[model samples]
Target: MFRSSALLSLLLLAIGGYATPVVREPSPVKLPFAVRFNNGTNGALNIIEADRARINLIKEQGAALAEKHENVHKRASYSVSVTNEAVTYIASIGVGSPATSYDLIIDTGSSNTWVGAGKSYVKTSTSSSTGKSVSVSYGSGSFSGTEYTDTVTISSNLVITKQSIGVASRSSGFSGVDGILGIGPTVLTEGTLSGSSTTEIPTVTDNLYSQGTISTAAVGVYFAPTTVEETTNGELTFGGADTSKYTGTLSYVSLTSTSPAKYYWGINQSIKYGSTSILSSTAGIVDTGTTLIYIATDAYNKYKSATGATLDSATGLLRITTSQYNSLSNLVFTIGSKTYTLTPNAQIWPRSLNSYIGGSSSYVYLVVNDIGSNTGSGLDFIDGYTFLERFYTVYDTTNSRFGIATTAQTTATTN
Candidate 1:
């Protein structure tokens, strides 16, 4: 899994920016799709090795995102499942009239809905090339290909007419999957298309809302904690959130205006480890493409010191003793007017899957890590899958705000 910088992330899904999802009918249309996580491998690397490599790559992608500001999944037809392949989330989607199925990575960090990374793009009566060259630079890979408008079928009930898609003639860094189903903001597409620097291609969600297939330009994402390589523990809803997937109120926060991060689904929030402050209110993003909860270097240091965790070379994650685990405090995130908590049990890596990442079964690994810089950077923290797994998130493009709420997994000790 490669990460894209700035507004350009996806299709190796460098997984960076998405598009503007606007609103239409007051009535919401529910389109459930299928999302699977790929916890499989990359050539010779096992699941854990692949995860570490992917994690390291995302750091590079984040740095690149800060520098370039451009490049940068789920189910439901309304269904989202996560399988473990390359440690990235994959979504199964259909394109063309006959509805050929393709497994694309579900990436909220990007908005380009393209295909042809692994499976060849199938052209039929519904496929039309727009004559525009599409390209995106993921930190570890890149792709440049022709652009096309095609009929996209997420499910029998949800179909998008003339959706913009990239068909890669040449691609590197993606394996076992097609291109990304970018669901990020529309602005990020500014400089991505070759020969069309200022052109903005409409994303799948953008078309869904515009077509009145859904009431609003929003997508609800749900992820459940897992220890196995694959499971149907994820869900994606288009148009509006699935009220059944979350508990309590779905609090909303306006997107942050900070640079770099502002180009994506950015937000502002603060963090605390128990009673002590760890990270001050700062701007960052919540990403489905990212796999961990990363904070600025300074905050990470404080967390490491607070928990007395030592860096584990084998897994590239922090390790703690049983005693430390017992004494660990809840890590709380304050976003907008609400505070969400990550219990100690929720902070540790899924213990049952320790061996997958080359960690001892008895070892306790912490998922929170450093973003390689201090706080105060335009983008300080990234609430990755680790954080999202404990909460239900809503990307409301219509109102220009994001939503978050606790879920059944909020305090799960399954780890």
Candidate 2:
């Protein structure tokens, strides 16, 4: 009787195998994002101040990481929606079995996915504590909490099972958002969790690829210039690039070998204000978290002089007259033999939303700012979203390279 039952079980297993055919690989996913403005401590809007603070924190973090010995260590067809919060890009992600959607900042600077800054995390059947504590400081804000692994639902087609997430018990600096969805290099996750200093946490992109949700371990980012304070003008594509979003072929550049900058999605690039060079080829990073473009202090001084732009005390950005604006030269960036230009209109902040950043709508403000430090810092320039809005970017981890291409908005005079 035991032998007969075993034969029957084997037969049923064979039948089940035949019944379920091979599952097809997932396709690239695209996530739409919007723009929002977070009010300051005084209940007024001041994006420049907030952005500068964040930049300072990022520089400090990079420098500290460099001091420490380096030990650290998807493609789908569907896309998730994200928001461009004037200063920060946000995405709504669902967690747990009975998913509770939380608004998270889409950051390419850090790699520790967490929640519970603005909304408390809700535990469900799929939530399990990892018995480890996690904490991260973002210069302007921070959070400390217990680590938990749960089902993270980025979208219907982009779900990740047993993903590690920090449930913040205490957090500050993120008043409007719940937490950050870190999509930077996995190495950035090192030392953020307790009990294991060397163990790096897998980011959302990591899990998505490992779990067979996407074929490639890459993310393509597209951002349209925003003239309003709030609008959906960005997209995050997982697994692969959306070829339709870009024009011409995508140019690739290997990650920089320089330290600190190498710790993130670092690259080598030079800046030229029209025919004149400002910042020579230097190691830096491409960050989605930053609101404006930042170059070395020396480079900024040169740019200021060339554009005839004066620092505006009111907005803390370079102010130019209509005549200067008309004569404003294209800010050209050369990365990996490819030249990307930010036209005069693209260099200035959105005139329509000038008041939102505490600037007079009548006056023009340039988006390029000083990095507070000169070159040779290993991390000299930061091509922020302002630069990205005009190009299509691909963060290809499997290739250890970054890709860029011109887009329809590359020369748009929208701003």
Candidate 3:
């Protein structure tokens, strides 16, 4: 039932709560995430190379979606901790009654939730097969299986009943994780299910609101920069934004009208290296599935020239000298009327983990890379994990806007 997006530029959860006499306003549900680098089935740990490959696949997913025209449509106070996999965020989700917890990738790029890439699905009394086949192709990974509805548990305060999920009969590219928790737009689910070409599946967030488990259909994501290989430094807040996690007020921008980029959690932004405008106001996406900040090839070239960095053949990242690192300019992104800046220290990869990506300990590496294409592609840039680590983000589906604000680590020299 699953076909590769390469064949199609194409294609592509919930929880509940209890009652109280106090009648307090529903609080946002929170989930924690940690970062871990996948070693691949061959036991290799080249994160930079792996991330570059993933970027290509994500672009492919966007391109496929751009080719098709679609209408865009748009939580609780529970907290779950997640691990920050260096290249991906991992969260444990429980499925079925008497839930069996499975480690899943918390991805906002793709929207069809599935399992069985690693752990087998455990059917419970609440499980029901929809009799329809389901499949989704993530450029780096894919799964083809049957569609089923069951109870999905996010936290004690957050649970969704009769939520749809894919039970994978076959999968690939997802190692060390059970499957994905897609938080992207529900329209992306079109064509992912048999006999449902025009039907759009309700995402975990959508069901949460419809079921009255949360007051708002939104998710606030927070990630802090870390130097270690693995850490519990990220959280997913369902229902609404967590004010305490961010410093200033949240500023939201409407989703861009541009194609492909607009298909996901996309926005319009411009980038500057200090005072030089590298990327003009353009459309792109803010993706949790991507590891680094990627811009158009020409913009990347300008950045490389400005920073005096060379391509590191071993890691596929821009390499620079210590002196150049000290002289680096702040990479500023102007979204709407607000500006978010990445300090010079925030531009480099964590030096402590240099060896993990096949780089020398003494060499300095920049996290910015080329998107492998030019600016007019619609999806000309990707503000990935590196950028997310410095800001608080809100995917406000109910309002059809993306929100960003300063965080405690916005100017941290952690890297």
Candidate 4:
């Protein structure tokens, strides 16, 4: 069944490989999106507008999950590379033998790789039609197309032969990019094909592991907190965790058993405002596609009250004065046995980029917001980029565990 969320999405792509996969460090590649400032870059996101879009997007994702079982099972399109357009991260990849290069979005939310949002998918000597139609609908975008198995290459050492790829016959909601490189769970591929309802297509990460491209059937994600409009500050390590990317001990948490949330890289975690438990452990997903930290409505209310923040319609984020900022406490997340902290400085949007998000230079906006629902709704919260930028995340499909660790950005006061 298909579930969706809106706004702020990009698909990721990589080099395709067909050889016996080797266990090498699959380092994360830099997206074209510049974390630069003072330029009309990063899709020039107006904070207020982006916040509103993101709110609706997250709600769509949550609601879509709720309606999943009622609807016919369907898979969504794969990840796209992120871009400089404040809302996305992008990657450049090749399709076809003579390798037609394309820039794609990076997505972790959905899995089903395809192309032709901007540039069309080129059929090469390696292309072979699977004779099955494919379709997926993201909240902000959707695509319908034919399936093809082709020689995919990620790098010199990484390549997958006969990888299933969607050649979009129709698509929407993508600009300046091609399509997604979905590395989501293999199960998501279920019901994506027109006639092959029971078939499960392995993801890029899956191919890397099943074919021995990496040591483990896992992917490690690292994104740095950025003040600039763009930065190649992110890394994706295939197979195993990169000890150099993190500090202290890496804590592993099991995927939440909750429906819908469990469909993705979901987990059970509790939130605390310093010493007080604002939201007890609940089912939620960690989405690289999402942009902010979102809690259930009740938890949001408690958090807002605790922080003395007022809603700012202009930015779709909570607003606080300098005094409130000074009084902000450490917002802690208890996952597994480890406690990850989002310090006071980490809560507010960077003062330097307030105008970009359509806020006053003098005022500060909180990155934490409402998910449009309350706790116990199966899925409760989303630890988006705001949270990921501070911590490194590893998705281990083989072991069914999600790992998190502290990064340099964890203690950064950049915002």
Candidate 5:
């Protein structure tokens, strides 16, 4: 079972909780090896060097544009704090005046940091969500906030120069989440907030780069999951890769528009535990947003029966017998010519419930924790953490395929 509320609170503020004090540079931690993946069809592996070069190209482009304004490629890490169930701001972004902290989510799956608002939402022009009063909801809940354009600063590191951010009244039900910080390329863009009305908005990336915070057009993000542990064991370094966070090499799987973003490797024909095949499916999404691996019903049942675990309805989590949990061998998923093996913790997640049950075959609900008590579709799933922990995913949406590589692999140039 998991810890109590005290532990949970501590965990939230541990790594991903409060934005840490801003650092002047990306973490110098170097992982054990380079991360890359096979293209899945020809058995050609796409290493990190070339892909990194491309990503670097984009960063350089951003930086070049920034140099014209005497901008420096300054990046830092800041702690995000939730006060009174609401996030408070500490850094100041200098717009036409001083920029105040607003609520925001630091997301890697997304590429932009935007606030919800429009021209009419704010009485002042220095709002991320200005003139824009909208009700936005996530898988978590809903919040009402205005969007305005302002400068957002983290630890003296400028985020957006004149970016749009969402400013909400203390009454919004965000339950502590401030704004959405997207790290994906296309996912980040300027837009209008929608509710009863709409208004124009700018992304933090656009705002910051346009201003003089960092010289690069793109910013990097380092994030650790919100768990009940306060270890600096996890971090996402923007503009550079930190090598020490993981033991093995980094692997990659591409992201696509499909359900489970595509990987460089093909659908794992089937997963294997020694000689037995566990589950076979052609769909899976490599999401940085999720923390667990969700397998379909067929896969979930196979794992349950083979692992001899039981499902608890109260918590909607699966529990394997202590002996069963420890005795399980490594499980592997074969995608094209590549095979991914997972550790025990990667397969079986810790539960927070004391007791209750059905058989283990029913506990595959992936989203909303235990949100699948009465639904059938929820039983088949996998969260992103389990897989990402085992493999470095290379998302190549441009080519319609993703890549997967073992932690021992390194990124190399193809040509």
Candidate 6:
């Protein structure tokens, strides 16, 4: 299992780079009830509640933000099932009832959300451990499950109605997750299955948008600490877009052929340490499911060189000068044309394990960790925690393409 500390600290993702990154300022909108969550030992994200002025600012900017990205489509919304004890979202399918859901890693890095099937057969065969080898081959992880499809359903008061769905490939850890949810615009449906024979392996985001499982076409996600008791961790809004719950600004990032799905969002334009700009125009992805922000090789090198520390490249993770990281000012991102900035403390990531020479153990040292390439076919461009929690965001898909908006959250919106 991926450790909480490891998962929370860095933006570990695949690499894909094409265009130059943009830089800008953050939306003036502020969310009600400051999002309070522990960042483990390093520190917690001390997000304060937004003031009345900020709220008014968001209202003023809402329309222009909405009108900015009129071409982006709202991807698919998914049904999350609790098969085992774990939570996973649905991916895509191959043949037969491809609608059946499988355990997936809800990743914002990769635009495509896919599932694993051990030596696959008909829809009714028992799931075997054959996927263990497959997992090891891909990322040294495997899946376990049994072939079983059941009537699945998900609903939200903000959504159209109770949404019905299907589930298959019941597994222990693999199927435990409702299936991975990729919070990007491009659905991973384009490229033909490269190494595998799976044909229905569309980008999870694409399939969800293409399918009518969720009413509104677009979706929204709000995550709190595991301690906060709630039936749903976040909301995936469908059909209509709600401004009451978001800051109401939909920033965008241009996509390239290498971009996952047909198009991709979540690209970061810049990052800063104090007044010093480290990554002037770097590419990145915006993933809510990811706890930490991941950076590319060049950016990581520049940051580490400036800070005078060596970061490991294997895992795109980081542990900078704890005090410097905590004290830094706004960490910025420039999407398509708009720029969004987060307070400095938000960039402080916890070092899960004690640092040691490379091993599989979580006990790693503290230093700026360098990730893989973000140049080609990478999720490194997606933005994560540093950006989302501060604003009330909406995925507006009603007009084919989608854009984000800063919303005004009066009450805790439930999923």
Worst 10 residues of 4 by lDDT: 1-10
lDDT of 6 by residue, 1-415 (tens): 2212111100112123446432221121111111223221123221111111111221222222223334333222222222121112232223222234333444343333324333233442322222211111111122323222222212111111111112224323232233333444443222213344233233323333344333334454444322231122333343333343455455533442222222344333566654677666644444443334446566666666665443435333443454544444555555556655554433433232122112223323222233344433223344444345445344443444335544332112221
TM-score of every candidate: 0.84, 0.89, 0.88, 0.84, 0.54, 0.49
Compute the lDDT of residue 235 as modeled in candidate 1.
Answer: 73
Cα RMSDs, all models: 8.8, 10.5, 8.4, 6.9, 15.8, 15.3
**Highest lDDT among the candidates is held by which one?**
2
Worst 10 residues of 1 by lDDT: 5-14
Error of 1 at 155 (Å): 1.0
Give the winner by TM-score: 3 or 5. 3
Q: Tens digit of lDDT per residue, candidate 4, span 115-205?
A: 9888888888999998889997665567899999887765545567778889998987666668888887776777789986567888888
Clashes of each: 63, 23, 34, 68, 88, 76
Residues 1-415, candidate 2: write the lDDT tens digits: 0000000000001112445753444454444455566666455466566666666666666665665665421111212122222377777789998899888888888899999998899999999998999998775678899999999988766788999999999987786788989999998888899987678999998887776666667888888887866667777778777777899999999999997789889999999999999999999999887878999999999999999989999878999988889999888999999899999999988888777777886789999999877999788998988899899998988789999999999999898
- List per-prediction Cα lDDT, in the order shown: 0.75, 0.80, 0.79, 0.73, 0.36, 0.34
TM-score of 4: 0.84
Report the CA-based lDDT of candidate 2 relative to the real structure.
0.80
- Candidate 1 local accuracy as lDDT? 0.75
lDDT (tens digit, per residue) of candidate 5 on 286-356: 44444445455556566667666666544345555656756866677766556666655445532321111
lDDT-wise, the better of 3 and 5 is 3
Model 6: lowest-lDDT 10 consecutive positions: 3-12
Where does model 5 exceed 4 Å of error?
1-99, 102-104, 109-130, 169-173, 184-192, 195-233, 244-249, 257-275, 334-337, 350-382, 386-415
